[model samples]
Target: MKFADIGLSDELLRAIDESGYNEATPIQAGVIPSVLMMRDIIGIAQTGTGKTASFVLPMIDILAHGRARALMPRSLILAPTRELAAQVAENFEKYGKYHKLSMALLIGGVQMGDQVKALEKGVDVLIATPGRLMDLFERGKILLTGCNLLVIDEADRMLDMGFIPDIENICTKLPATRQTLLFSATMPAPIKRLADKFLSNPKTIEVARPASRNENIEQFLVKTSERGKRDTLRSLIEAEDIKTAIIFCNRKTTVRELAKSLQRYGYKAGEIQGDMDQSSRTAELDRFKAGTINILVASDVAARGLDVKGVSHVFNFDAPWHPDDYVHRIGRTGRAGAQGRAFTLVTPSDDEAIDNIQKLTGYKIPVHGGGAPAVDVAQPDRDEAEAEPRRGRSARGGRGKAAAKAEKAPARPAPVAEARPAKPREDRKPRNDRKPAPRHDDLDGPDDGWNGPMPGFLSVGFDT
Candidate 1:
């Protein structure tokens, strides 16, 4: 259905059109109408399904008539990560340009002075991560008692980040008569219990089955060794015509290192991790979004609620530890019905992890690129690992003592020999008269095989 038919204001519709969106996504189409009717909603849809707009669009319309009081926002939206919270704020800015709604973003890694100022002026909407919001609430910079509309977005992600207790605390601080909308990609029991305890009788909407793969995304897995993961990722990037892509790593250090490696190879790559300050993270993301950087190396922090359009490929540099993260990482691509590709680099050690992902998704990911795999070392199964060969002294058995004794046995005297004058009728020149051999690059013919000098990355304090 069209955005115009959903009872949105002309201003909101104009902003939508300017953003080049006319028809709503399945999730948006399902939740927009219900949200406009002031009903609590439990939306079950995966990431990248336009779920952000599902709430943001209607929240604008619902909050248009209200004036926020000092220290009290009219509506509250909670996200699981800083990146997700910032993205939500961007959406509000883009969609609410025609309206005069004031919004504040509360996230970690940033100073609270400006946030306190925004709260003092009051706001129509407050988007925040759980940790930062509570910090502000404790300092008496903001008040949640007046917030009548509450949205706990990415609820399942909250549970993963260990934010459920914080969520429960925040829920208690809000007025009991407020409307709560909880949205998630999967409905795990923890999230279900939270919903049952917090949300009043709500309208439930499931746009797609839980953990269901998107038909628009083509998935492939590559079996490679741990040492070859970088090489495999490079090969895939060259093989695919990726307009823009995100490379997921399980650790923050991996994210930083992979991004540096890509940069050394002359790719426009950037890195984002929890260790970076808020300003640096913002700058890197802005560069990525503005096309200055084409590749982003990130951890699971970006797995949920980040919406960047035209991501043609996603490379899992490291297999995710959690099965659900596999869905979120790949979901970054193939968004809004756009056809995309996702390639995962699996190593021998990742066998069990990948298997768990397949089990959760209920399908085997297809193998692609016929040839020697990027990583040839297949990890041994449990049984093989248990039967591993003995090592060192254990493997020597009874011969180790004799071998040590033989090494210390006295050596026989050498047979006397008269040194004979060497005959020098060979092609070798006299040592003093011979010049240095030609360097590899100076040799002639294609057989000489001259590539440029090595990058000297190791000398520069980086890994080769």
Candidate 2:
């Protein structure tokens, strides 16, 4: 369905067209109408499904006529990360171009003065991260009472980051009669309870199954040793002839190191991780998006809600620790119905993590080489391969010379012993006839025979 068919205003439709989108994505088609109707919504769609616009498009029209009061935003959008909040703010700017909807972004890692000033000026839409928003609220820099529309974007991510309590606090501060919209790629029990507690009779719209893999994405597992991951990644990148790619690492340190490694290998690569300052991160991301860097190494911070178009491939340099992250990390590519490939560099230690990802996605990812079996089912073979050496070492007691000798030496037969005769008891001397043993004191006395200091052997012959 087109944006026009979703009952968006002409101004909003014009903005959508200018942004080069006519047909609404499944999430947008299912969600925009309910949002426009002022009903609460529960949008469950995987990443890269245009869920951002599902609410942003309708929200522009809803807040078009409202005038925001001082220190209070008309609508509140709570994103899990600074990048996601910034992305939502960008969406408002791109799609709300024709409308006079004021917007403000509240996130950490930047000066708060501008954000405070924006809040004082009253924004029609407020895009904020939970941490920064909560901090500002505590300082009386912002108010939530005027917010009639609340969007909890990436609820599952918020849960993962331990932001659910802050979200709950923000919800209570908002008007009790507010219309709340909760969106998540995968709804865990906690996210479900959050929606149950906050949203009022929300229309649950799921464009796809929770945590479902995008069909446009071709996912493969590249089995390699832990030390060989980088070489495998480089080989795959060259083999695939990747135009642009995002390499995900499980650690921020790994992200920085991998990016440097890629650059040293003559690839244009950039790094983004939680440790980097906001400005630096934005700069790196901008470089990646602008083609200054064709490969981006990132932590999970960029796994969700990062919309970089034309990402030709995704490489899991480290298989994600969380199963849900596997979905989002690969989702960086294959966005907007574009065909893309994702390769996970799986080491032996990542077996359980990869298994969890397969189970969560409900299908085993194929090995990079098509003829080989999938990684999930091939785990036993990997285990056996690893155990084979251990079993050999156990049987041989290691490869030492002694073990070799033990393996080669023949067993000796038991030797026969000669029988010995026992002495007759009557032939032995009587106990009374034996002389008393010399004492050490007697031997060391002044009258002792030729002794300045008794020899050590003589001392041993005497009893104490």
Per-model TM-score versus the true fold: 0.81, 0.81
Q: lDDT tens string, model 1, 306-419?
A: 788899999898889989999999999998889999999987788899899998888888887663474434332222232334323343453343454566788778899999
Cα lDDT, model 2, residue 238 = 77
- Give every collision pair in model 2: none
Candidate 1 overall Cα lDDT vs. reference?
0.87
Model 1: how far residue 18 lies from native, Å = 1.2
- For candidate 1, give the lDDT of residue 48: 88
lDDT of 2 by residue, 49-134 (tens): 99998999889888889688899899999998889999998999998889988999989999999999998988999999999999
Full-model lDDT, candidate 2: 0.86
C-alpha RMSD of candidate 2: 9.4
